[model samples]
Target: MEHPLPECPIARFLTVLDGPWATLIVRELLTGPKRFTELRAALPGISPKTLSSRLRRFVLIGLVTRTAYPEVPPRVEYRLTPAGTRLQVVFDAMAAWAEQDLPRTGSARGADR
Candidate 1:
């Protein structure tokens, strides 16, 4: 059977956020505004190029805002907009569910060891 398209706004939003590194990037931004280097340090595995692309996409989607400061060395920071801040509710719910339903470690999905 052919798959039906997702019709809900939540589903549509997830499609954008469900991409690799997107959710993690959102989580990091939730804490506060962060510079490029700070986000890179927070998420150890993401490549600089990939992070740059994701930041661009997020800015385009209006979920994130990029601010540049004029200085000897230019500095840029990323922060979630009001629309993006609303997503924290969904993120919190997901985290709560995972904490309760998933095993802490060993043989379970996402277990470190």
Candidate 2:
């Protein structure tokens, strides 16, 4: 069911969350900071190009912070910002709902296919 635009806080949040990939990114980051390669490994289905783009967008939106270490190989890491961490409760609630309410699909709530 669709609700009126800009009228609800959740709707606005969803707008920022946007696409399927964004939520997945958020979910993964909930674990802790991770390098590009780590994220790529965790989300094997995501192409490098798309992951780069989403990380860029997340950085721009203040939901994520990218730190580049001045090392020989230039290691970079991504972590959620304070505002981003605020969504942990939301993620937890979703997990609870999925475990209690979703159909038993013989896998996780949002497991990669």
Candidate 3:
């Protein structure tokens, strides 16, 4: 069954990428396609279960695609769809904001007034 997204654009975005892992996973995929082991290695401290869960959620939401090939041991690759690639602009904007707006450690810029 298909689920409707929230009316608000921000809410809809949050509904799709609700957690840190979601965006991080997308960021990794933005570089290129990767296998399970590669993704696990790239993201240290992320449990296999969590990675699997997030990938499955991404596949369900149309952000990622999983392709499996038949072979001796079998191989699987995960890649971002066009919709997923579109998130690059959002990530770029976020990076720009963080670099320009967010303060450094111990800086008074972001401190309480």
Candidate 4:
């Protein structure tokens, strides 16, 4: 028989958002819906292949919706679903923590060598 799944809420949430580059992608989407190319431009460090994979995972988890428009060139846009929008509070709390409690080391304070 298969083992029962874990009951922790944090673990459950992370399972959906724990893939490589997932948080960065969600942060980008928090700004607004974007086309694939636009998201690539905004997140300069992510490769096209990785971005595609992350988008696929987000769709699977129902956090994002991809819409396609028929045009001379097919147009696709990614937007956060209702579930995703609700995560903004979590993101905001994280941001607030970073700003308020991050260590004020010399490097963090921008002290030059």
Name the top TM-score candidate.
Answer: 3
TM-score, prediction 1: 0.83
Ranking by TM-score: 3, 1, 4, 2
| TM value for model 2 | 0.82
lDDT of 2 by residue, 1-113 (tens): 25555888977887768877888888999999999899889887999999999999889879999999999989999999999999999989988878866757755545544
TM-score of the candidate numbered 3?
Answer: 0.87
Count of clashing residue pairs in every prediction: 0, 0, 0, 0
Superposed by TM-score, candidate 1 places the C-alpha of residue 106 at a distance from the truth, in angstroms, of 5.9
Query: What local lDDT score does residue 11 receive in model 4, on the 0 to 100 scale?
Result: 88
Candidate 1 lDDT, 1-113, residue by residue in tens: 15654799879877669765999999999999999999999999999999999999899879999999998699999999999999899889988867766756634465553
- lDDT head-to-head 2 vs 3, winner: 3
Query: Over the stretch 71-96, how does candidate 3's per-residue lDDT look in tens digits?
Result: 76999999999999999999999888
lDDT of each: 0.88, 0.87, 0.89, 0.84
Runs in model 4 deviating more than 4 A are 1-5, 103-113
Question: Model 2: residues >4 Å from true position, as ranges?
Answer: 1-7, 106-113
Q: Pick the candidate with the highest lDDT.
A: 3
Cα-based TM-score, every candidate:
0.83, 0.82, 0.87, 0.83
RMSD of candidates 1 onward, in order: 5.7, 6.4, 2.4, 4.8
lDDT of 4: 0.84
lDDT of 4 by residue, 1-113 (tens): 15544599888878767854788789989989999999999888899999998898789768999999998689999999999988899889977866755555523432332
